[model samples]
Target: MILSTTPTLEGKPIQQYMGIVTAETIIGANVIKDIFAGLRDFFGGRSGTYERVLQEAKDYAMQELMEKARLAGANAVVGVDLDFETIGANGSMLMVIASGTAVRI
Candidate 1:
């Protein structure tokens, strides 16, 4: 399905509004990854481990969003938005949420 951050897709007219769809994913940092991230923080460098984890979570959330849209009989999702937050004790968990309006084009 097509996914766009804009309200409407160019060239393709929206045929139906299938309501809003949302998906969420939460991931926790492993102890080893946290250790490496802490070392990187001390060395003033980017944490590749954390970056990979965040990217994976975001991808999973987006996939879920697309699945929900498809289940709603939508071929596209418009006005897509992604939100990220850190939760759990000591902010050890990362939460990614994908939301959009399911639409038929």
Candidate 2:
């Protein structure tokens, strides 16, 4: 299935609007990883642990969004939007949400 951040896909006319689809993912820092990430922050380089977590969360959210779109019988997802938020105690957790309009082209 095709997914686009724009409202429409070029050269692909929308045949039907299948309503909206959305998915969210939340991940928290583990104890050991948190300690290492803290050290990386102090040392002034990118935190690989955090990056991995973000990537995993994003992938999971996207997967879920696609599944929802498929269940909606959509050929594509348009006007895709992504949101990121920090939650949990001391903002120790990460949340990612994906939303879009499921459509048939």
Candidate 3:
């Protein structure tokens, strides 16, 4: 399925508006990995652990959102929005949410 932040895909007309579709997930941080992340932060480099987790979360959420769109008979998702939130102790929990308007071309 096609997904974009813009309201419409280039060279494709939006034929039907199928409302909003969303998906979310909560992930917990690994204790040992968190300790290593602290060290990485001090050293001032990207944290692979966090990046990997978020990337996975984004992929999962997008897949789910796309499935929803598919169920709605949509060929694409427009105005897509992705969100991340940290919750629980030590900010171990990550919430990934994706939403968009399902549309048919």
Candidate 4:
């Protein structure tokens, strides 16, 4: 399914609005990853471990978002919004949420 951040898809007219679809995912930080990330932070460099985990979380959230749209009988999702948040003490978990209007275009 086509997912776009814009309200309208280029050259594609929306035929119907199937209501809003939303999904969220929360991934906990792994101990090994946190250890490596802490070392990287102390050394003042990027943390690949954290970055990879966040990326995976985002992908999973988007996948869920698309599944919601499909279940709503939408061929596409428009005006998509993605949000990120850190949860738990010391930001031990990452939350990714996706929302959009499910549509047939």
> Model 3, which residues run further than 4 Å from truth?
none
Give the CA lDDT, 0 to 100, for residue 23 in model 4: 94
- lDDT (10s digit) by residue, model 2, range 50-96: 99999999999999999999999998999999999999998889999
Taking all chains together, each candidate's TM-score versus the true structure is 0.98, 0.97, 0.94, 0.96
Could you say which candidate leads in lDDT? 1
- Please give the ranking of all candidate structures by TM-score, highest first, separated by commas: 1, 2, 4, 3
- On a 0 to 100 scale, what is the lDDT of residue 58 in model 2? 96
Clashes per model (N, Cα, C within 3 A): 0, 0, 0, 0
Where does candidate 2 clash, by residue pair? none
**Candidate 4's residue-wise lDDT over 1-105, tens digit each?**
999999999999999999999999999997899999989999998998899999999999999999999999999999999999999988899999999999999
Worst 10 residues of 3 by lDDT: 24-33
Give the Cα lDDT of each candidate: 0.98, 0.95, 0.92, 0.95
Which digits, one per residue and each the tens of the lDDT, describe model 3 over residues 49-87?
A: 989988888889999999999999999999999999998
Residue 96, model 4, lDDT: 97
lDDT (Cα, 0-100) at 58 in candidate 4: 91
Query: What is candidate 1's lDDT per residue for 2-105, written digit by digit as tens?
Result: 99999999999999999999999999998999999999999998999999999999999999999999999999999999999999999999999999999999
1 or 3, which is superior by TM-score? 1
Best by TM-score: 1
